[model samples]
Structures are given as structure tokens and as C-alpha cells.
Target: MNCEVYKGSRKEGAYLFVADSKSLENLPAALTEQLGDLEFVISFDLATRTSLASADPAEVMASIKTGGFYLQMPPGKDLETC
Candidate 1:
């Protein structure tokens, strides 16, 4: 499956992945509001073995399939407390 990637303006390194481009109707309003502005990153093929920076491609695809979207938040700042 192909997926569209969007970067969150409010948070650095935050990303949103959806099954379709410009399709946010299925996502909750609260999530959209929290994400602020979105910038298109790129379209990716989930069927292929493509590596992501901080998330598993397989998990992302699964989320998109089940929830219509996948949220990838930035890594925690402090590992000691995590």
C-alpha cells in the first residue's frame, strides 16, 4: 500500500502518515488541531521494505490500514526518565 507523509509544523520531527494524500476526514479533530499545520513530505510504498527514521514501516502500514492514519511523534528528550 502507498502512503502519504506529512510533517507537523508545531513540533519538530513530528510526522503523520495517511493512506491517501490530502485525506484527513477520518482523523479526529483534536489530533488535527494539535498537529497544527501540515507540510507534505512524500509518498511512500508500504508494500516495499523502506526504512523510517524512528518508526517501523510495517507498524505504520498496519496503523494506516486499521485507523486510516499513523502518528509518529518525536523521540523523548530524556531517556533516563522514560
Candidate 2:
């Protein structure tokens, strides 16, 4: 699978993981483990605006300072064209 990491900005911060159907199931656990050391961390479905809306401000800020976050894209997404 191909993966792309999106670093957030102060005005609109988030980690967006886009994957094909085959890789979607594993995203949550993988993201959790990968982000384990971060503070005030949480994950939610990308399809819902409310989910992203609930992100903790403090956590987002911390993540921004700590090199931001990563988005795991499915294979064939071709991030270079995105």
C-alpha cells in the first residue's frame, strides 16, 4: 500500500488517511500504534465532519510542533499527483 503524510496547519489541522477498500480495515490500529507516544491523541472516521471537529486543540498543537501527523494512503493513490 502507498502512504502519504499530511502535516497540519494551525488554522486547519488534521491527519487524513485515505486507503482503498483492501487496506481500510487496518488503518485504525496502525495509526494508533504509530501515534502512541503523542499527547492528547485520538482518531476518528474521516467521512464525518463531526469527527474531525472533535479533535483536541491541545493535541493538534502539540502534533504540529512535533513534526505534524501522517496520512496513510492506499496503494495506487499516487500522492505525487495529489
Best by lDDT, which number? 1
Clashes of each: 0, 0
Q: What is the TM-score (0 to 1) of candidate 1?
A: 0.84
State model 2's lDDT: 0.37
Instruction: Show where candidate 2 strays beyond 4 Å.
Output: 1-14, 17-52, 70-82
Q: Using Cα atoms with residue i matched to residue i, what is each candidate's TM-score against the true structure? A: 0.84, 0.23
Residue-level lDDT tens digits of model 1 in 19-70: 8865677788877777778889998788885787888899998899888898
List candidate 1 stretches off by more than 4 Å. 77-82
How do the residues 37-71 of candidate 2 rate in per-residue lDDT, one tens digit apiece?
32223443433332334444444344434433434
Against the reference, the lDDT scores of all candidates come to 0.79, 0.37
